[model samples]
Target: MPLTFTPHPFHPADMPPVTLITDETDDVELARAAHRSANPARGRIAVDPTPATLTSAFLARDILAALGRTAYAPTRAPVITAAPAWRAVACWFIVDGIRELTVLRAHLLTPERAEQLSVLRELTGIRLILLAAPSSATQAARLGTCLAETGLTDGLLRLTADDARAFFTRSLPTTTPLCPTFPLSAAPVSSQPGAARSQYRAGQLAACTWLARHRRATGQVPAQRDLELFLSRLTCLSPDPATTLARIRGAQGGFTAEGLRLSVPHALATAQGPGLSTLPFTARTAHHISRAVPGPPQLAALASLLFTGAHLDRLVQARVDDIDPDGRFLALPQPESAEFDHHNPPPPAWYAVPPSARPFLRAARMFRQLEQVPGHFHLFSKSFGYRLEALVKDAGHLIPALSHLHPGPAWHHQARLTHR
Candidate 1:
């Protein structure tokens, strides 16, 4: 059933006559004009208070005409409303009663709408009224036409700069004045002279060295999980087991054999040097090795093997002051752990240094001086593993015939025995 609005009381004197203005052909403008000219104070222009029912164009026009007549005569204005969606009637009503219109959400009005409003006022001889809300260029252009000529206010006018300052001063005495601030530019980067090397992080270095040593001793690399377990056995390792395992994985270079993994392309290798069958290396090969041997850690590593044929562990733990200047000897230290006690101990306390190793020892001493390596206690820190690999790399760069001369622990041990 269609919903119908029924009056509560059906008494004659109790209710005012409700005129249902359904006839669109009625000359509403003439009737309103006659009513206005006859007796403006006596006649009341009844507007349908419910805007929802005022959906048709004819209804909007009748309401606007009634409002116009009431506005022109000596009388107070009655409230008449039009919906935003019904464009033709809304445009007509707005242009006609622009000075009297009050809208909600007027900022949502589009440029096309503002343009339409301009065209509407021009064709309908209606004066447009604008409010403070829609202040875009399009809205302003439409408003400028009526406002400039009619000298009408756009609802509320903006305050002058001086007036605004005075108003704030009077209203807020202790409030902080706002000021704009700009950010400073960033610093310039410094330049480096040589070709940039791939950054092998410090964390990965120790794990790589440990893995290489393992592969050398057992002739097989351990699996990733096994490597993690091995690193866990070392003291002063990362407290987080997961982080240590991650570092080991990062150090590995993706080579696997017999379900075990090896991190090749590392700074060092464990390839054995030919013992009695050692051949002379070319000057070019020696030059390449010299250049490839990176920094003091690698230099110290190479020097330990070539000079006194000291073991890797003893070379690492040996102190700077352990070297005798006049005697040309490196004082090897005891093993940090007795786990390797069954293996041969270092040659002696003061192992003789070869003449060929003198230059490298001098270079190591100079590097120590340059770096200001402190404490005559330990020659290299735990981070020494970072450079140990580079020494192996230098040996690897040798010419094919001289390649077998790559210094391994066994070769150094043999050299030490031969010297003695």
Candidate 2:
């Protein structure tokens, strides 16, 4: 799929020629042909083949980086100096709304991050995109609030199926049309409606696979509502499933009566599980975590449980001041706010140091050297639990007793058991 950016608002008189940024090499050729053929006055349109996330900061850095490589003279418009690799065959950049790229308000961008973009914009003269999809009225309101323009909204043209198809064909001459004879299905019936929706793109691939298999077995495409239900359920894993479904439904604008069939790429369409290693935890499993974990942070974090029954978050947030090195004791912090989980409130203010103090001290000493007043430091990274869980899974293969523990539950169970 082509790397698509949200359209920005701009005036024709002030607008610079459109530049397509993509990680796909083939897209470079396609975009070049299309843009040049469409308008010679548009000047030389450059299709950047870089793989950086199209955030304001990253794009600003990329634009500045590209300035050093090309012989092109610097102009008022920003220049890209570095670009990331993309696997896309063809991508596009449109002249419409080309000046200020818009970020979907539904993403719930933090105010701090938005201010950072404002700083970058002042430095680079590149306006950050702040548009939301028109399908969402609430999002539109939120976007207005973010921009301090509550009255502003861009009207979206709802195109007919034929109009969309015509636009698509004219827009990219290089795109090969999916042949009608292809035994492809767009949406699939999910066997596990109750199953937690995986990732967005993952669910789409799975749904497509299910649709293809169903067609092969029953010789009929599923109803539209069925597809909608599958997507609604599948997208529940996302922050806004309703918005996600609306986006998906909006993309289905061109689906014909026969159903919109697509060629599923090999890598993405392949069925895969959560890819976590599985095994139950035993004392031996705990030992594996201790050994497999190669850092003081992880070791110190795990060893803390041996001395005190603190929860994972509490132990990680412990600071140097919380430790009484000479007294052979540790103090867990109280919750800063009353909004603690009812089931797992704050631990006691103090805990006796365990026999594993040698390594804990080593870890603590190392942490102090890094930063003297390291307040509320973490021993293990956010992902450490998953890594430890995976280690337990790998250990299960060799140790028969650990084989019964499923990695998902086993990880949580071990975490809960830390308090005991």
Candidate 3:
């Protein structure tokens, strides 16, 4: 439903009947003309023609003085709360019985700021939105026309529950991804350059190392979820799980039974090093993995695998059957259920070895291995695909068009480069 405002109740005495003047020579017009004629004393002004002088504060002050006097008024202006920059000039038109003021305010506006103004107008029922922006006169004039056509001052506002759903429904493009990028493999700690020591890079390095070690130990791949948790822990940055998963899917690489692998560009690999690795992973503090990895798609994929594995291991060990469809899965509380405590977690779920879940389990174990051996020469991209398929089998139903979107090496590289 269109949003409407209930006008405040008005006693008959609160509002006076608007006076109408049919003739052009009305008192208001006469008053304005008389005021203008009386103020016709000419003032000579000189200005330096140089570029520096043109932008000088003194010149700006003089210009403001001249403009201000010409547009001066004796009447007190009404106060507007949360007025958008573009609407500052049009406030007079929005307020009933105030159109004769002819007062104009100088301001600037940008396209993004203008959109913000529109959104504010929709959210608030205020008319005569006055803004103070530094936009060009032509741009302001165009915006004024847009305001009028859109009825931004007078029309009912539109509201929606979920902006994302609304956007897709209306065929609006979603925001561009902003995930971080890093090198393909965890670089050696001793070989780190000054720039590589950034908190982000450090986290990526730690995550990569963790994944590589896990892969080597388990002879399997890691899932996207596993990578996500690993990175999150290393960086101490947490992103929405669903959103992170989506970005991982969009990033280049795939999960496999052997390890999480990302296809690194020949250029990047040559420039940085072979098989990037992250931090040394320990089971005791594995929960620290939640930081995001920044890099090309392949790096992003590896990071996702590392971080997500850490998170899933904890979650799975906490309550095994929570995700299992069959009734065979069991929940074992920590410090209470010795069967799945720190010393001994329930043997991998029965389904872990089955055709349906075996691939995912293998990927998970590979991520664990990567954590153990931070230095290893592995086929990064091939590992990524294998892990990706496993994650799809486990959680593909949670996303839209999971089967249709296939991320390429270029896409991964572009995702990393642009994001970084």
Candidate 4:
């Protein structure tokens, strides 16, 4: 599995074994040796094909092993294959961004496997390099047939030993290393005089704002997922709030520029008024949410409340599929069920999610998805009733003005998680 550089069969209609790359002495190991010089990081992978099983599933798994995806992850897990084997193979080629795929044993391929590879190449636009000499006349005939089935002409650029040597002049190191000194956030990031922040800047400005405030709130570098989720949330927000935008830009500047840590600009410092030490109402609420928000459903509901323009009742009906792919809008009634006509279809209700609040909504969506909740399932039904009192207590503690001290029989303004 760890990149050891190292075959398949045929039917008639087989073209003569198309010459791929051949060494001077006809040694297959020599043919496979070039993989040592291939750079997997740069989207080039040379596979040692495990072609013994001869089934399509086995071929698909062989390709995956070469691409380094024989592992489970939220995005790349292959167990729940979204497509059939050959299609999955093609899909992963795109997902992993592969440009060149080198297979070590060209002579061993079956017509079926050759067809799969050729189809994959067609679908993904990946360059296929077949190596190894057909060790016998039978293998040579079969390989020719395989190549014909592959739908590639014998004209595939044939590199001689000298050319192959020229191509793989050097080997790349096996792994990439990470740098730790990369900026995470800045609570006391040293401020500096620079060109003034442009008022026109938007998304990056929002990112910096979140990072600056996050550092102020937590007093340390964010966890990796937290930073990624924070950026993702900022992507969801509206740009009208210039204060948030400017702060976000400052945070970005820290990462891009050499010396500037993500401190708020003097313009925002003066305009937004006092800093976190003064304990502004929103800041206090942020603290409470950090410490006491019940869970994803409650937190997401509170986040949506800030900018969604929808009431608690509307949000209570939110389903896992409500939000758009970009995480910016939550469409009420769901887009699929919304009316569309020939002339001008009436648009469904578009509820906006501030980029700053998208992470909360995303967390809630993920929570629902993990439980295998269907698209139409309500997000809040399970958690709301039992946790309602605790949430109301927290809400009131954070913002007494908007919250009711006593509860009603059904969910109401007083019972909502608005303060978070």
Estimate every model's Cα lDDT from 0 to 1. Answer: 0.35, 0.33, 0.27, 0.48
**What TM-score should be assigned to candidate 4?**
0.43
Q: Which regions of candidate 1 deviate over 4 angstroms?
A: 1-286, 336-348, 380-383, 394-420
Model 1 lDDT vs. the true structure? 0.35
lDDT of 1 by residue, 1-420 (tens): 111111121233322221111112333342332233321122222232223332333243433344332111211211222321122233223222332222112223344444443333332323232222344667545544534343233232443333433432343323222222334432211112221111113334554566577778886545433442232222112222233233334444222212334432222224322111122222332333443333333444554554333345556777756665332556556542354453765433444444444444544543343334553756443324654453455445422212334433322222110000
TM-score of each: 0.25, 0.23, 0.18, 0.43
RMSD each, Å: 36.5, 26.2, 24.7, 16.0
Q: Model 3: C-alpha RMSD to truth?
A: 24.7
Query: Residue-wise lDDT of candidate 4 within 54-89, one digit each (tens)?
Result: 655566665655554341221211232212434435
Off by over 4 Å in 4: 1-19, 23-32, 71-83, 160-162, 170-232, 235-420
Comparing candidate 2 with candidate 3, which one achieves the higher TM-score? 2
In terms of lDDT, the poorest run of 10 residues in model 1 is 1-10
Error of 1 at 264 (Å): 37
lDDT of 4: 0.48
Indicate the residue-level lDDT of 402 in model 1: 26
Query: In model 2, which regions exceed 4 Å deviation?
Result: 1-290, 336-348, 371-373, 379-385, 391-420
State the displacement of the C-alpha of residue 217, model 4, in Å, after optimal TM-score superposition.
Answer: 34
lDDT per residue as tens, model 3, 243-300 = 2223233232222222434442444321210012112222211211211110112222
User: Distance from true position, residue 180, model 1, in Å?
Assistant: 69
The candidate that wins on TM-score is 4
